[model samples]
Target: MTAETHGDRQLAVRLGELLGPRHPVAAAAVVTPEGTHVASRGTDADADADFDFEIGSVSKAVTGLLYADALTRGEITTDTRLGELLPLGDAPVARVTLRALSTHRSGLPRLPKSAQPWRRTITLWRNGTNPYGETLAQLLLQTRDVPLGTPRSRYSNLGYELLGHALARAATTTYSELVQQRIATPLELDCFYVPVTADELRPTALHGRSRRGRPRQPWTGEGLGPAGGIRASITSMARFTAAILDGSAPGTAALDPVAPVGGGARIGAAWITVQVKGRPITWHNGGTGGFRSWLGLDRNTGTGAVLLSATAASVDRQGFALLAEHSLSTGNSDSNSNSNSNSNSNSNSNRR
Candidate 1:
């Protein structure tokens, strides 16, 4: 084999070894600022590792991006309230702002009580539950125990569902369509979408599991699509990561107008920040019935990669941490531009 081919195989094999082979489903795409792509194991040899995976919460980051795009276009503002955009029943969600929902400070529940827990029994693509509309209906009927602008962070899926719906309303379009027009299409992400049917999912899509260690069928998150329910390939995600790292992806949308979440350095829109060794590792992971995936980018180095797998393996922590360490070391830079932007955003809120 040629040296380049051998080197690629070795990288994939070493990644597999370090993270373990149990990661039944795996796809990775690494990209440099110069626009070079390194496709590793588990990717379809025919494609550019552009295959799609069921990116769980990573979808929220997409939603955040879409919202930012809307703001840039003057479709909405960060202070827009949930109740004003969407017709919430008796719930005071109207007081909840776009910033609150995006940053996880909205005091919304992690998941709505009405969500059917049948994900374990049904196929992931076919899991049935109330659609986004019905989920919002239920939210209107419920009562929130906390006041608006609560400092605590509970990580609510229902909250994002609301944000997605609000964004759709603000854009005067469907949620899926808004995501497509605002982020996916502009970014030239050919393999990403919120598929309505299982057949629409790629064969390489990873599956998620339950706490008992069994595969789950397709499940509907009720009003949580904004928080998750996104599927894309490693190639698409690599571009997505690159856009986030350098704003050089096919799209030119801003990452935020909603601002950095919490006093903690772990979340942006939907992405999470993890400090590996001493460098900041900005990333996010998603697990759904029949699918689990992770994406990470080293902001300091402008380098990133996407890992898509069809298995419920627990190798995410290892694979992401390992790649993060290597990438950070390779592309270390002193730029604090992203951090400074976030810090300025949090200057107004005293809550931790």
Candidate 2:
């Protein structure tokens, strides 16, 4: 058998072991100097590279890229305020800086305060409805009442949502359109996109399930587009990962560590960088009502890995382990590698 084919088989076995038998559907890919290898585990006929999965907050990482690219284009500056672009009259949040928002130090709450968050949560648990279905105007109206706290390093979906829209406003376009023009089209990631509503989802979009196997409605909305509304196929993710590793992706600067985000980790825009097995691995994980995703890159070794699951199960550790293994297999690192246990525990805490 060819060496590459045998390697692919072994990788597939390892992926299966990581996912276990209960996961209904998942797709994984490992990018190395040799090339990219993809694998899947599911019985569904539509489970393949082209099947779209809600990437959740990994969309923030994409926004991080846009943020950096915008900086390069001089469309905005780190000191830019939200009120400068978005029409948030005198809300305290309007004074927050783009840099602070991107690093999650804007003191914005994890989510906008709903008059009945408990009711919303219950509704989500019972019907799998999209709670973040607010439009841009609705989001702005909601932001008008949001009170900001002391700037600190806290993961805030609200911050990214506002940051993305402000950037879009700077470009004189919508957040979805800005992403299409800057990131997807440039990288040729045809299946990567943000759908502002459930009805906008493509027919090939896979239906996700809850942790206990209940089917879920797709999570899509104009307000969530920059934070958790992105959906992409495994094939598009592979291309995106490869582009990030090769510095060909727009806003590649977003991967650089800029501020410490506690636990000995650092943040750059929305991406998190942590030392795993003595190597600095940059990554971001996402979770929604029905889906989970993780993408990690070992830039030092030019290797990366992505994991997408149609169930609400955390896949951060598997992604880290895959990148570590791929790095070792490519003779890019020492053999004393171990998966970063902290990643699985901390990365998915901010579920969308």
Candidate 3:
């Protein structure tokens, strides 16, 4: 292996040191711009590591792809009002557009307000986080307080839920169907699925450990389906992120260049722009009840990795940051070897 290879290995080692030891990781895949296999970990043994796990908010990136494809087909514009797309009532819902929803500038809260009752009950029981239906409905009913067009960087599940609903109306298809048709199908991401069950979920699946110290499986049911319900493999995500960086996805040709968000951190559609040691990196991560996953890409190099685990502890930032930094510093791409390692570092504090 070259120096780059060693660097990637070191990064993997560091991640394992931080996140491993009985942490169930189903699959981990890394890829290069040239489509090289690179490094990896976990089981390539078919059923062992190939099982699917919920990718959570990484659903946003998938949703972004759907909207981009719609925009290209002239089906809708980013500035298209949400009200026009969905029957969001006569309450100035048009003030919120697809663009704001994609970039998370919609000023909506994380979940909808109507979810307070169920959420409170869930929290009390230490169950999973409820989906966005009730919360989104509540917020919609009280839009006056949260006005439109105000750019706030709140991570809004409500925004994505709206996007999902709008996309369904605009495309005349459900959110799950649209994601399959627009993103997964084109990319040949066969392992990706939505609204999966615990049995449908892989045993290597990760569980959610709340900030308040509660452990639960993150399933919000079909009502919250579009917001945080997606499961995919590391190999598939690596290819997906690689396509995003390389401009290979169908609608990428018309995409506005990813703009920097915080400092060198840029966001295009749904991908996060990260600058590690001055190297331009674009990536995204997902965490459901127990499963956590990370997708990192060096846009400049068009190389990246998909790290997925069955444990929340497996997908922390320290593990991913070390992997990214190692990928950059050593110039190696050992993404084929599967296994796992991670530490919950502040590397991606912005999104988490």
Candidate 4:
């Protein structure tokens, strides 16, 4: 068998093994100098590469890119306060700086307070409905009464929600439009999008399931788009990872580590850099009520991996192992094999 075919088969097998006995639908991809390798586990109707999955907080990584791009365009600065762009009035959140927001040091809670988050959480657990379906205006109103805690390196979905909208406002556009015009269109990620409501989801969007196999509602809302509302197909994720690795993605500077985030890791905007297998791996993981996802990249090796599962389960370890294995296995392949494989993969990706 051809080496490329053999490699593809091996990757598929490994993905299946890693997934093992759980998760009704999942997709994975690895990018190397020899190009992208993709695999999925599901029935014929749902296994296509174009099937969309909610990416959850990985949306923050995209928002991070936008934040850095805004900085470059002179539309915002690290010190820019929320009040400068968003209508937060004299609220404590309005005084938070953009840099602090990006790095999760803005002292905002995990979810908007105006949404009656505690009750929503109970409703989500009982009814499998979305807990973060607040509108942008609702989110802003919610922030008005939120008391800020001491700023530290804390993860906050609310921080990103505001940061993204503030960045969009700085550019004189809405957050969804900013994402479309800047990242998705420029990268040709046809299925990459932020849905403001459940009805906006494409037909191919997969229904995620809870751990006990209960169907969960799609997490979509105007206020949540920057935090956990974005969705994309596996192919789009693969292409996005490739762009990030090659430094061709806009706002690549967002991946540079700027502050420590404990556990010997550093934060770069929304991305996290941690030591894994003795190499610096920049990554971000996400989970909604129904889905879980992980994306990791070793820029030094020019290798990256992404895992998307329709069930709410951890995939971080599997993602790291996949990337490490791919990096090691292809580290010394001959130039001709690498060229041929990369050509094939790139051609197929472009055709999609």
Candidate 5:
């Protein structure tokens, strides 16, 4: 119903065209300074607004929110090191600053090499195994062996995981609790951390599918939730992004670019920044065993978009394209409206 009205069908058509038939089930939304619009595909008779899928690394942005909130409260500074927050022993990562972790510059690898990541990848592809079963404690144990490189833009899931854990420790709570209380509650979002399987998300979790549309294992596990554990609907994300652009969200400081990510792209806390049509856009994307998601915003125009899909194929190019188009549209509409107002006023003066 909501998807059937309010430009939902039009947005859904655009999404469908971008994804084609590969990602049959998805939801996309655009939020402007004016209001929010939502659309969904393959959600026919069995889903509600709360229905959603894993948001993957977009969870990094959530972690970034927690970090920013703490920063504002003087709980932690950008310069705070991991060792000061958690009892990380002598791991090289212990010396890394919170800022570095947030920006993927802590020199940590994408994951602990000892985890046999390649094996896990093969198993996941062949049989849909939940490869991230290692708990936080175990993951910590493996971190000592991770060679810390010079701070640069290396995408590290392990870095965010550690950062989330350390931030939780700083707040005297678990990562899941920290996210719920600090970010979700403050923002009034219905999002859930879903440490493992969430019964609520089950009724609507678009059955995880592979690139070929074969059923794949849903990405649910402990420990990795901090790194990629958030589950939410398009509406939920749309509202959240809207909050960030409107200045009501607590963690938007995370969007402040800290270092160059690559080739003219800069990285904020967990968000990646790039110029789209001459306007700066900060965004992040995620993929699990069976889900793909993206969130982006054009702060210059207070416009944002979120795209979530049940299939593992990426929608990065499409997501960026859509956000760019909307960002440009918002600018053009403002200029055109102003021109029209002036034209009408001049016409009225002549008639008078």
Candidate 6:
């Protein structure tokens, strides 16, 4: 008889504690600028490091990266109005700037008005529904002259959906195609924007479970792809996070905070910045049906991490703990020394 490997036992132990018997196979990964570590708490020979899971709202930050890269390429500025890119017509939302949408200051609601009582009840129960079936044409038709709240950092899926579409419009490509061309290609990530009629996903897509441990429907619908349709393996996310922290990612500019959202949280294009033990940490979390994911970076310490789970359990707390490792004094010392080394190198080169 073959004995279980230490990693497998550890995963079993951790999942046993975190899930308390409700566990559906889960995985977590930590990706620092210099290294990466991954652990699996459940077993599935088919679901190795390459198995992709829906990242939910974490797609917003990915969209933010696309926005920042667009700005870098001089395609559009943050001040660009939504109407300038999309065919919003004379809708009041046409006046909202891409900046406002990226920072969630456009005053758009968390979701469209169409998602109704069923959405509320199902979400509360984690029943999993494809709440985003409205196509781009439908989305534009739904826009009205409804007044919005004052500009501030309020989470808005609708705003991001529009923002992604606008960015794609500016690039003359579909949202998924833009992501693949700009972000995934540069970083060599295996992630993809999964559409609702995704026939290719049947073999790899993991079934999501409701909070009550019942299996739920898969999250699909191409219309909502911009807001929350991307999926990737834990390792792929880790690699992406590592790239962002090191400034190699095209969307690196998205990590810079653009506006404060009170209580010490600042909003970037779509990423949120918070302080942990006095070091700035940029992060975003996502959840859909039975999946949840997180991406975080600490530019000051040149380190970052990602947490991806196949269950709907929020990974925010685990993300915070792992990401905070960079805030420790040791990590800062290494960063300071590296900064000094780089400064000296630059000075010597200048002398020559």
Provide the RMSD of all predictions against the true structure, rounded to 1 decimal: 7.1, 3.4, 6.5, 7.6, 10.3, 9.3
Measured with C-alpha atoms, the lDDT of residue 280 in candidate 3 is: 56
Which stretches of candidate 5 lie above 4 Å from their native place? 1-7, 47-49, 197-202, 333-352
For candidate 1, the per-residue lDDT at 33 reads 61
Cα lDDT for residue 29, model 4? 86
Report the poorest 10 consecutive residues by lDDT, candidate 2: 1-10
Residues forming the 10-long window of minimal summed lDDT in candidate 1: 343-352
Q: Per-residue lDDT tens digits of candidate 4, residues 1-352?
A: 1111122566667767787757657888899987898776673443334788998888999999999999999999999999999988888888999999999888887765666677876787789888777899988998899889889977788899999999999999989999899989999998999999988999889898877888989998999998778999888899899999987788989999999877788889998888765567788888888888888887888999998988887776777777777765666432221110100010110000
Give the alpha carbon lDDT tens digit for every residue of 27-108 in model 6.
6666555566666554455434356778888888889988998998989997999989998778888899998998888987
Residue by residue across 118-155, what tens digits does model 2's lDDT show? 66678878987767788999888988888998898888
Decide which is better by lDDT, 1 or 4.
4
Per-residue error for 40 in candidate 3, Å, reads 7.6
Residues 188-228, model 3: lDDT tens digits: 88677665344555554445554344565556444344556
Model 1 global lDDT (CA atoms, 0 to 1): 0.58
Off by over 4 Å in 4: 1-8, 46-49, 330-352
Residue 248 error for model 6, in Å?
1.2
> In candidate 1, what are the lDDT values of residues 153-176, reduced to their tens digit?
657766777788788889888677
lDDT of 5: 0.75
lDDT of each structure?
A: 0.58, 0.84, 0.58, 0.80, 0.75, 0.67
Runs in model 1 with CA error above 4 Å?
A: 1-7, 38-50, 116-151, 199-215, 219-222, 249-264, 332-352
Best model per TM-score: 2
What is candidate 5's lDDT per residue for 172-226, written digit by digit as tens? 8888789778767777777555555444355556576777776766666556777
